[model samples]
Target: MHIAQDDIMQESYPTVLQLYKLALLVPQSTAVVERGFSAMNDMCTDLRSLGQQTLDSLMRINLYQEELLEEDLELVVDLFKNKKERDMPL
Candidate 1:
């Protein structure tokens, strides 16, 4: 039934995004995937040491047999933010 499909879609993605209209979130729909790419590209584009460059690749390249997902980037950004907050002196 249509209702069952609706429920399935809802459970599959974030609530903020409409399940039927996922294609309209151009550039990005839920989270900013490009920002991280730009960050990684900027970091990787210029390099003096090979180890740091490899690290950037590892962080940007998703290891789960895919490029990357929006949720994955958000989690990475959140992790970065938390670290920054924890390191900041009160």
Candidate 2:
């Protein structure tokens, strides 16, 4: 007597399925935006001066690559070493 969700969606609830698809497509909510602002506040202290582009890049890395931030600095530095010829040590 149990019907699968896909079967139910296909059989008699096309409108519901369409609504569900639209809901999935909706953009992220305000919490993400608030988190971005919070990150900006934390990163932009008085001692450090950053250009707008640099600030944006740092904020993005802070917010999205949080887990990567927890990793070892040497491993992260190694990634940049291969990208270009460096005149000085990293």
Candidate 3:
């Protein structure tokens, strides 16, 4: 049997194409996601739920911890220390 290149090219292999696309989307490992979850679990508890923004910020700080040094920490502390407190209205 002889087949032309055009015939092969024109064939609609939707299933194969879709499977290939999905394969590309699959992660090689779930370790990173699992690690993040583990960190979150350690940081939070059943009795205390953090706000979404606070959780996200804490996650980022935890993730990039290796990049932060003692000086960086002190600077962060200093900034918060110097920040003005907002007055509460009755």
State each model's CA lDDT, in order.
0.58, 0.77, 0.78
lDDT score for residue 59 of model 1:
59
lDDT of 1 by residue, 1-90 (tens): 653357665676645346445555454453456656655566555554447768556655644325466558889887888784465566
Deviation (Å) of 28 in candidate 2: 8.0
lDDT of 2 by residue, 4-88 (tens): 3578666798777778778778877789889888888888889887889999899878876857666767787887877676578
Candidate 1, lDDT over the whole model: 0.58
Decreasing lDDT order of the candidates? 3, 2, 1
lDDT of 2 at 14: 76
- Angstrom error of the Cα, residue 88, model 1: value is 27
Instruction: Give the winner by TM-score: 1 or 2.
Output: 2
lDDT of 3: 0.78
* Candidate number of the best TM-score: 2
lDDT of 1 at 48: 41
User: 62, model 3: CA deviation in Å?
Assistant: 0.8
